[model samples]
Target: NVDKAWDPIRIACHVYIALHAEKNEIVVEAETDDDCTTALGRIRVTLFHAEANERTCRARYIVEPPPASYMRKEVIGVEVESAEIAKDRLDRRVKLAGPWLTQKEKEDWEQKRKELMASNEKVFADHLGSAFINLCALNSSMRMRVQFGNIILKRYRTEMAKPGFAFDKFVNMMGQSRTGADFEKMVGGIELGFKLIHKIHQSPDMFCPLDNMTGKLSDIKPKQKLIYRKCGNVSFRLEADIDITVRGGEYQLGENSLYKEDSALKKRLDVEFLAFNSKFDWALEIMTQERLSSNSIAIQATAQDLLSSATVEQDVMDFPYPTLGPKRRLNGKDTANIHTIFQYKLMGTPYVVQILLARGICSDVVGYCGASMYSTNWDDHMGPNEGEICERWKLGSDLRVLFPLPPSTKQSSFATGGQVVDKHEGFRAFLAAVDKVQTFLSEAVSEK
Candidate 1:
């Protein structure tokens, strides 16, 4: 929708091409050759010329009813997670805490049970601390990935009724796993597994579509173009990037605690008011009429005008994307980006979110902390089948802010910046604003 709406020219084209089994909607047994490059292993292909089915002179109805023999209709992306959580860890902790909480009903529970049950937070914290006791993670680190699939999108709540217990409820963390497919499901789609214990519903996944997104993106990319133009490479790229970081990372948290800097710590507590700034920078390229068009990998315009980089990157792939040199490279000379930095507290927090003006179709998480890159050629990708220019694009996807959402900013000049358990208006306002951005993006996707 975004692509066609932006520039119909970049939509799918027709050409002779072969797609792998995964894409062909065909099932095949294959072995992996770790030592080999390019792909896992080559499988035999039973080619059937389109002329054999229904002949056509040029590309006609190429983008629709995908070459029946090529693509399949099977769901492509993530699915809603249904695996039941393994309560063993949680149960064990419960047992240690006393199974009476469960054995006895609300009216029959014992005094200890009542006392312990009085504070699920205290119980969770106690068990969490115990769990960490055996954990060999000191200078160690823990990580979990969240991606768009059959996941749920939700807003944050001010008061968390529970301690985000179920200690090991997340599929990969403490949740149960299936037999064969466990390995490939590295990142758990947002499930009712482990979470902020508060906003357990919001999955930490990032999705980039040709246009705006409503939430889950499992059905967007492939369905958009049932049959793709094989010969003509339809590529996309992004140009802008914004980084989002929450306040309580190992470094800052450690720094604060180590120095006992109450004032410094209070200003950058876990709870925060969300704020970011987005800017766009763009330029134009003018060239010959011949250069304005080509039969090359067309880039689909994204959120056409809402964001310059989105559309510009798409323009680079197809017609009129002008080039100046003897090679007649992309003439569309300018690119733009969006810069967003959330203001945590009156100062800042570790929860950092980066909004980059990316242009193409790519998937990635937030860049690793302190990551750096050095590249040489950056234009080769712009050239045709074979180009002299060598360029590389590195992008990252959603890194959902996993920190517990505290209804609002926890600002203080001194004293312990404990959790905010009273009001939710601040957090609600934050989510509302964030949603407005989504609405704005959706508007961008819809406008062009």
Candidate 2:
């Protein structure tokens, strides 16, 4: 479908110029037959006459066959005219036949040549060099001009075929360059690094506990060790349960359980203080230094707390504890009295007990105690007691007198037969106590 005739004409013109244009000058002209339907055109080229005077010739060309060409049939008649025959055509033809440059032609060529050279020199000087660099000057309107300025410079270097160039070093230099805006670029890299570190640190598989144990007994296995995948720019510590078997016993016991139990008791003394230092260390590394925000810390803490709480619940289910109060006393007085003083009056009272219970310490006892604490105080306050106020007074007290007394008890009568509180109700009460503490802190902080 492509027309090939035009290709040869183009090639012939190029060849004529290359061969004869010593000074690299081109001259174009056209000629036509009688009907003007067929036209022939040629280009005369001349090269620099460095050794010759302005009037003398250095190199010239009347292209072979004069670089002849004809126009297509359709437009030829409308656009072209026939060659004149009145003049001494044969004589003129003979004189111009050899495709050589004459003295006068050479003089005229030299004059025009000087003008063109001057113009080109002026343009090159005005641009200060290649047009490409000028196009990328600092004030360009294009947005990409700024964003990709370094990229363009790098590409130019590659085009020039420079060897041993390091793109990362180049990019770093550009990011810190004094010539243009760079804060965004530098921050962009920092942000990317932060995200990558966080993702690697947070992935569960990064700190997997590899073991050969499988099947139903895997959960009860005695020996389990943790292995961490290699990570860069970050450090981690395992705070998880590890089960180790005793030499004489067939059973594998949770080594972490003892630690968790002791830690839990310490938690009662001050839950916030128990892991204070470690938590702060993690926050400093993962948040401030690593650029993760405080919100990330809160999320991780919530997840850990939820998981630990669930594990504690499972442990309690596996091993039940004894009920509170004397079993033989049957007037319901012993249970009622314990419930009134402990459950209602001192259940969630802060500093009453410095020891934290591992498996709810006394799960049944605490529930009864909390109920008694609430009941005794309910009539006096006519509302829920402030949990936060109590916790603050307890935890934030002087070191010498860390323990505080619970609310004073008042005598209250209860029916001989009354509905026993359900487990769900007890849990709800516990959560209420926790919520009151949280709510008070929230309000206090807001006021500040």
RMSD of every prediction: 25.2, 42.7
Model 2: per-residue Cα lDDT over 126-196, one tens digit each:
22122212221111111110010000111112211222333223323322323121011111122232232
* Model 2: lDDT to the true structure: 0.21
Q: What lDDT score belongs to each candidate, Candidate 1 first?
A: 0.21, 0.21
Model 2 residue-pair collision total:
15
Number of the top candidate by TM-score?
1
Q: For model 2, state the Cα shift of residue 54 in Å.
A: 96
Runs in model 2 deviating more than 4 A are 1-237, 240-423
lDDT of 1 by residue, 1-448 (tens): 2122212211222111233445654232213323121121221111111111121111110011112222122211122233332222211111011122233333333443344333432332333233222211111111211111111112112111133422112212211112011111112221111121112113223222223334333232110100111221222223222112212321010100011112211111011111111111011110001111222222223222222221111121121111112232232432222221111111122122212121112212211111001111111222222222121111011111222244335464124666444333332333333433333332332332
Best by lDDT: 2
Candidate 1 residues lying further than 4 Å off, grouped into runs, are 1-139, 142-430
